[model samples]
Target chain A: MIGIVGGLGPYGGLDITKKIIDETAARSDQEHLPLLLFSCPNLISDRTAYLLDKSNVNPGKAIAAILRQLEMAGATIAAIPSNTAHAEPIFSVVQDERARMGSTLKLLHIVYETVRFVDENYPDTTVGILSTAGEQICSLYREAFIRKGFVVVEPEGSQQEKVNNAIYDEDYGIKAQPVPIANKAREDLLLVMDDLKKKGAQVIILGCAELPLAIPERDYNGMIVIDPNRILARALVHSLAPDKLKPL
Target chain B: MIGIVGGLGPYGGLDITKKIIDETAARSDQEHLPLLLFSCPNLISDRTAYLLDKSNVNPGKAIAAILRQLEMAGATIAAIPSNTAHAEPIFSVVQDERARMGSTLKLLHIVYETVRFVDENYPDTTVGILSTAGEQICSLYREAFIRKGFVVVEPEGSQQEKVNNAIYDEDYGIKAQPVPIANKAREDLLLVMDDLKKKGAQVIILGCAELPLAIPERDYNGMIVIDPNRILARALVHSLAPDKLKPL
Candidate 1:
């Protein structure tokens, strides 16, 4: 069973789970999988909290609680849908919880799987990374993509601020009109994609899950955009059905 | 949290849970649903035993155990991925489980949901039903589809036996190749789909999940074959996100 630890604003964990289910179902020749969702939007602080470091919010405890509950309910394996949660201390808590429960719940690493997918599928392809400032500045996708032998491109400082402001602005939420912010984020992503395409990128990776919300299906100058969430979904499907995934 | 009443087959529970996760992850905007799978294929009886009425299978008790475990683990609703287990005493057992736990776990009816999907999506279209003898002879899809104002077609007596034989034959399992028995099953399904198309059927519903295994993407004389499992996946996606379901 899959367990998701969500509530990272702008990350979109629910979208990740949906992609995983769709890809797996479309590719499999067996029974459809069942799911349980636990959305804890209030459990942790926003991404900006880690940037400022004013008050340390330990997402580990909350993640542990969710995993323990999932294990108690008989989940074989669990996954934290958020990429940033793969940080040292946070990931440690998940391992600790599995230890405590005496269960073999494998916590899937979203970024690691995405990196593997890119390496295996689109080898030597330059990738553009569109994510929050917190992830960008922290170099979340940079090291991994670089190690995988792919060039990772990011937006300029000005564009990065614009993308961050749009995500954090409370007015956008109240107005329910994410168009302006989405447009800015999309523009920023397109710029990165264009630059990478010039550098021989056949595919652009939406390293940030929220970036897809901004640029749903916009074609970037004929370059194929790869949302890492979609990649992770494909990876999970392959893991579940090796025989079916062999051809794809 | 999602609670699965599994062991219908050794891997049925795991398979369904995987689909739910993959589908949820594929969504554009949503948090991943945490899943809890309770796989006890051992709790289920052999199909032969149930069909012959020589033994009894306590699906109610099995479902109850899963629900109670999920409720304790903080699940608000539960769904069983098994299609055939929804008959007779099992439904009552699920109700009893809810009552006993003082929990309001919504157990989803797979067949009912399939009927609702066909009625709403394929409105005046005739449907071809391909399922086990029990499901077909017992009028599982016929009753629901007819009530919703749709024509339902099934295979003839000899054709029905051929379909059943393909599924249970030991030799067929040893050799994964599609043999004559399996081909007959596929032909029967195609015949029903072809007849329904002549009678104005636009879609053919693969009522049995295993049928998809036997006939993977079999073209039914230009009629669109609808795998009920896929429909069920789409249904769950829509149920989780009502606003996301687009006009088909």
Candidate 2:
């Protein structure tokens, strides 16, 4: 059974689950994958806050505990859908915790799989990204794409801050209001995409799971929106039953 | 945390979760309810087959075990979102299992809450239902509405068989093809509904959660369609915090 480490702000889990639903080529419900969604949002700390040092509490420990629950509940393979949660400060501790447990559950690397997708399909293309301030400033995703021999583009100057505010704004931020996402969030993302386009970016990856909800899959405003959620979903299908996975 | 006893057929869990998302009066992610969906479909047997006595395995024992897992996972209140799951043959065993374990988890009776809603809003009106043969033929729901002083209507003869096949045809049934639900399921339900309208039925309860996905909410061909999943979502919010519930 597949396990989802959800509640990393809640909606990412739902997003990836829906993507998995679409990814599976099934003629019946029994053919659809059996999975468990352990969305204990209260147990998990905010990933962006921990990475930003706004909070000393690292979310990885709680995330590790959730995975243990999923493992105990019969999930052989699991994935955490949040991009920010993949940072050094958080993911390092998650690795430490899992090592201590000797877990048999295979935790898929959301960013690693995504970078591989780009390397294979959009090779030699200029890649751009939109993510939380923590991920961009930490260079977690940028370095991944750079190592793949791809020139990574980022929002320059105050445009970076604008994108961050659009994601973190207390009242209208995606974190503050995930569903019925603020109109400004979409408008701000589109505005940033225009900047990336001007920079000669061939593909813009929605590095954050939350960003994809406001942005479309594949093409948005003629710019390629590479949703890691969709990649992670396909990776999940590939993990257990490769033949059951639909063609890309 | 609210625990959902999902995996009765898998899609029902997704259905109820989405409804809860819609029923929530949240402008932000934190305001949304924290939920755990434990969907182990392979662990449980077919409810319809058990009800028909074609299978000796009772689903309640597995259902009761799932609730225990939910309770241990820190769920204060839990619910099983299947109508047929509440039948005497299954629900009685569920209660026995719970009593034996001394579980504190609250399993919301889907049919009971639904009957209460019908009694309060559409009083004195004939009620029509579309559900799995297990729920209908067993008189599990019929007796409840009868006790509430309402005449219950069901599909006649072959129409009832058609409704059952649409939900469990193995090839085109809802249990088999929940996503991109088979068109025959919707067509079969509409045809049966037309007959109910001719029978002086005032409110048509989408008694089965699967049926609600194929049928429109509130109105279907000008007939009042009562969605139990919507009502159950409201009930969940009311159990936790009534003020948080979006008005009806």
Candidate 3:
């Protein structure tokens, strides 16, 4: 059974779940894919706070506990839909959980999966990233892309502020509201995307799940905005259940 | 943590999950409700088949197994969203599981809860039911309402056929598509509602989860069409997390 470890900013969880439903060609209810979702929003500590502030709470250990919960329930293959949660610390904790609880749950790592998709599909060597400051400070995407032999570019100076404003704006941040598409946030997001394009970055990665709410599927002018959540979902369908991919 | 036992039909599972999200007054991800969903569409045998055909596979046994899976994973409160799954046999199996495993999972019985909702809300004594043939043969809603001292009215022979057609129509059925509103089914569903209204049913019930898909919320002319799924969801929120309802 496929287990979805979510509740990391609930909208992302809902977005990926809905995408899975839309992607599958289920004419009737019985025809759809079997899924198990463990939505522990409060259980896991905030990745941004933990990573940026060196908070006492270990998000990695919390994630491992949630994964162990899924394994106990009967999930052979599972996924934590948060890109920021797929860092090395979380992976290490997962290993620890596997050792302690004897868990065999194979996680679909969103960051690695998105990078793989980029490597295979896009020819660009330098990619722009739009993500939370936590991911930026953690060098989450930068180090991974560098290991894959690609140069990564992020918004510099005030341009970075605009991206952060669009993401963390109380009324307009992608996580602030039920629907993430606010006019003000969209306007600011467009500026950030344009600045990234001007900075010699060929492709942009919407590393934050909430980013897609402002910058739609084809918002960027000719530049590919890789939504890691969508990529993770596609990778999951392709790897775990390829036949479900036929509808999309 | 709340565990949702769904995928008896995929959309119902999604609908309830979405309702929980919508009902909550969560500004950010952390404040939202914690939910674990096991969408085991293939695992449970068809309810109608088991209820009518004397099928060897017991739906009660399947539901019990799913509930057991949830309890094993750390779900203290659990609910099965399927209306027809609350039959005597299913309850018996649930009792058996609880006895065998010493389960402390508090199950929200959808049928009983819905009946209680009707008892407390509407002053009118008569009600109409639009549901699947399985529910009709098993007298699921009718018996429950009768026990509550409410007069129950079902669609007539031809009218019942039309209701069933609107619900089970391969292409037009609510379960046939992700979004329940279908034009052809809606047209026929209106006729069924009008017939029930003419029969002096003070309130009409979308007894089957799929019925609400074909018949929109406001199609019952002057009468109230009770959606049991929404009622179940509301009951859950009210009982489990009253604080979350502040935003709504």
Candidate 4:
């Protein structure tokens, strides 16, 4: 069974969970895929905070524990939907924990899959990155795209603030209370996507799962919004049932 | 941690998971509750089919197995969101499984909690029941309400067909495909609510979780539509946390 190590922002995890069902070629309720979710929202430290500031406690150990818990819960392979949490430190922790437990719970690399999608489809097109401050600080998206031989454009400092506000603002942030989606946040996020388009970006990557809660699946402005959540779900489907991989 | 025994139907499981997040009073993601969800959608047989036909395979044993898996996954309390699957035989299976395992994973009763809400808030008011034919045939809602000293009213035969259509029809049924909520099904289900109001239903219980996907949570013809999903979420919240029960 596919396992989800979620609650890295509850809405982001829930978004992936819902998308898995939407990604399946299920006509009946019974046709959907089986998913085991360990949604421990309270356990892990804040991803952006830990990555942004040295004083903040790192969530690597906590994430590792959760992954082990998912493995114990009968998850053959797992995906953590938090974009910022995919740093080298956290990935190392996951690998170490799996090795120690002798568990074969494979971790789906969301960024790798997203970069591959860009490499295969967009090829030489310039990609714009819109994600958390932590993701930017850690250079996760920048490094991934650079390795794929793709030009990456980031929002200007002022525009980046708007993106952060759309994701972390108390009143309207997608990660803020009363979530899943918000209209005002969606409109604000659209403005950021528009800004990215003006910077010669042909494809935009919603590197963070929380971003998609504000941004719709339809093309952002005219640029294609590559949601990591959908990409991860598709990758998961292909991993579990390769033969059934034909446009879920 | 609260464990959700889901995939009785995928959307029904997702609905409850999203509601738990929505009902929480967390200002940040860290304050939300931890939820472990085991959503093996294909594992169990169809609830309606089995209950309505003796020839059909019973899902009781399969559900019990899923619950056992949830218990193994470290869920202290559990809830299954399928309304029709709340029959006596199912409950007995759950109890029997827990007994055999010597586990204390308490199962929350959605139907009982919903009836109690009506009994406490709209006492002595005539209540309308809109649900699957399985629920109606089993007299789940009617029996629950009558025992609580409240008058119960079901749809007329012709209107019942519309209710069933909204729930089972492929293009628009809540459980059919492409779910959560549907517009045309919502409009059709609202018409049934209007009929219930005409028959002196002071309050309406969305007896099935899928029904709410078709019917919006608003007063229908001056009647309060009591959503069992929301009721079940509230009940779950209370069971997990009695001290935090102010307003969600």
Candidate 5:
């Protein structure tokens, strides 16, 4: 059973859980249906907190509370889908919760799973990353991929701004009308991808979740594009049932 | 710091770790170099073990020993690259190691991060998976993605055989030269991919680590491809330092 510590962003948590269920492989009789438990608390947003430099409500406790609930409900393994919540202090609360749960439940790290997937599948591939300026400049994908022997590519100055605008613009997630600013952001990603391809990038990773919304799979050229959420789902299934996953 | 628990397959472990470093984001001032710890305990090969089922090896203990070493070396976080080693008993050993390490270290699951990356980036899309019969018949990705709302597709019988042959055929990984059997596997994957595209799959996921070797991005059609290992590397970067990863 899988318990999802989510709701950092309503859509992201739900999307990740759904991906896990959708991508997991099932046997003829014993299908892998993870019991999902979600918690979406009204915590301060990471974007607003980071940009404004204000005291933001930490969602870690809320995440822990949700995990406890999942444990009670028979969830054996748990994972949080929010990337920002992985900060040391925030994850500490989660660790504490797992400790309290006493070995029955496993708390899975979202980022580690993502990096492991890449290493196992795309050894020596040069990859272009599209992510928040925070994720890009701080050495998120850059640090791990470089260590693993993959080449990490990023968009330059103005193009990065375009990507940022697409994510933070108020009209970005309106869900009805298409915003011109967001469209420009999508176009900017294409330009970056093209440049990366020219530089011999075999794969382009959408480092930020929001970036995938701007550049759908259909728009990409022949380059392989990786979205971490899907990879994590497959990993979860494997973790939950390794013996059942033996190949023929 | 990220500690890789590798060498499960000798060179494959080194190869995976190298890929993570190479693909991660880095800068002039800050570098994302992880603390890597490896243990290569020789054992009967996975292919042989699966085929003969006569090995007296304990993959769980091997992984547990590595985790213990990483924690003692002061690794705050850890991940394992071997897919088959994720069985429950093996992971249980890992959990025990975390507990013994004063519970300060976090063991990251590769599948969880992969799902989170996809959910963050690609919200509503259809994805096709190419993996070992173990992964596919076991329903590793299918259940997870379905829960997340992404459509999951798999190859049929003969295609599955082709994929398996491509990876395990004596001429491929074991031999220096390319073989006709390996080419047949690649061709079969392409045919399955075309079928998936016709069935509305927007992205094709190379779920099995070996499948990436069978299909190259250049030869693929315009569809987006996902390599799980690369996604895992990016996710690890995000896990280690979320705040530092800002776009320039």
Candidate 6:
């Protein structure tokens, strides 16, 4: 069984689960992958808040706690869909906590998987990342792309601030609005994506979980939208239930 | 925390989760309810097959087992979204198992709660139920409606078969297809609804989880489509954290 460490913002967590279902070439309900999603939204604090030192609570312990529950419920492999949550402090603490508990649940690294997927498929491409300030400030995707010998570009200056508000603004952010998403959030994201496209971005990555919901389509006016959620989902399918996975 | 006993069919399980998110009047991600969904699609056998004596294995045992795990995971209230799973044998088995183990997990009765909602609002209404062979054969909703002094109606003969196919047929069934559903399944369901409308169905009850997915809108060409999943979600919110629930 695959464990989804969800509620890294509720819909964002479910985005991975939805993609898993979509990516799997299931002929019947039974043909789909068996996964458990633990989405205790209130239990885990904001990843960005913790990363930015706006909050003292490390969400890693709470996330690791949920991972432990998933394992207890029979998850053999697990994945956390949030890019911001994959920062070194939060991600490493979760790993260390799990290791201390001797957890055998193999947690798939979302950044590593996305970088590897890009290396094999779209090698040497200038990758544009649109994510929360947490992932950008942590340099999570940048470090991974550098290791993979690929150029990385992100929203610059006030454009980056617009990207953050598209995710974090209390009034019109993706997380604040209902599932169809707010017009302001979508517009802000589109403007930033256009900026990235002009910055010589051949490939675009939705590094934040909530961004994919805003830009649901993969084509995105020919920028080759790469959702790390779907990439992580493919990684999960390949790890254990390879046959259920569809050809990309 | 709420536990969702999911994978009665993966998408059906997710429909309730989606509804919960929709029904909650939350401003941001943290404001959304904390819920866990365990969707082990292959673990439990088909509910209809077992109900029809085509299989000896009772999915009740497996469902009950999952409920126990949900309790351990810190779910105070729980719900199974499938209509057929609420048929006496399976529903009671889960309750009995929880009782035998001294479990405090509150399992919401989707059918009963739905009927009560109808009774309180749409009093003396003639309800039309669209469900699987298991629910129809078991008379689960029929019994519940009868107890509430409400008139009940269902698709008769060939139309009933079409409804079943919309839910269970291997080719174009809702369970067999991916999200967005099959055109055939949706067409079949809309035809059945037309038939039900002709039969004097004042209120339409989407008794099966998958039916709600097909006919998502509550106001289906004027008939009030009573989605039990949404009703169940509201019941969960009401039982605890009533503040989060949007007024129905």
Model 5, A153-247: lDDT tens per residue?
A: 77768766766666765565312223333565566668878887887778887766566566658236888787766666666767876644433
Tens digits of per-residue lDDT for model 5, B8-110: 5433344455455445554320243433434233321242244235565545655666566556645677777655555444456667765665656777766
lDDT of 1 by residue, B1-248 (tens): 44556555424454465555445542322254544445444444444345457657655676677677766766555666656666655566668767877877666677888788767766888777766637532477788889888876766677566556555555552123333335655565556556667766677776665666656573567766766555555565566655544444
Which DockQ values do the candidates obtain, in the order shown?
A: 0.08, 0.40, 0.56, 0.85, 0.02, 0.68
Which number leads on TM-score?
4
Off by over 4 Å in 6: A135-138, A169-172, A182-184, B99-102, B135-138, B168-188
lDDT tens readout by residue for model 3, A114-140: 788889888556788888746542377
lDDT of 6 by residue, B176-229 (tens): 774669999999888888888887888998877778768888877567899888
The lDDT of model 6 is: 0.84
Q: What is the docking quality class of candidate 2?
A: acceptable
Number of the top DockQ candidate: 4
What overall lDDT, based on C-alpha atoms, would model 3 receive against the true structure? 0.75
lDDT of 6 by residue, A18-124 (tens): 88877888765667788899888888888888878899999999999999989998899999988878888888889889999899989998888988998999998
For model 6, name the residue pairs that clash. Answer: none
- Residue ranges of candidate 4 with Cα displaced over 4 Å: A54-56, A135-138, A176-184, A246-248, B54-56, B135-138, B177-184, B246-248
Order the candidate numbers by lDDT, best to worst. Answer: 6, 2, 4, 3, 5, 1
Q: Candidate 3 vs. truth: CA RMSD?
A: 3.7
Against the true structure, whose lDDT is highest?
6
Task: Report the C-alpha lDDT of model 1 over A53-140, residue by residue, as the tens digit.
Answer: 7557756667777777665655555666666666655666657766776766666677788778778877887776666646543376
Real contacts recovered, all predictions:
0.07, 0.33, 0.65, 0.92, 0.00, 0.63
Cα lDDT tens digits, model 2, B74-124, are 888888888878888888999999999999888788888888888887799
lDDT of 2 by residue, A58-145 (tens): 8899999999999998889999988878887789999999999998899998889999988988899998888774644338778888
True contacts kept of 3: 0.65
- TM-scores of chain A across the candidates, in order, are 0.79, 0.92, 0.89, 0.88, 0.80, 0.92
Model 3 lDDT per residue over B170-195, tens place? 78765554264677778887888888
Q: What stretches of model 2 exceed 4 Å from their correct place?
A: A25-28, A99-105, A133-138, A157-198, A220-224, B25-32, B52-54, B100-102, B120-122, B132-138, B157-199, B219-224
lDDT of 4 by residue, A1-248 (tens): 88998888787788888888777876567877789888898898887666557546778778888888877777777898877778776666767766887877888888888898788877998999887747543387888888878888888787888888887788878766334566778877777778878888999988777666566664756787788888888888778876655573
Prediction 5 global C-alpha lDDT:
0.60
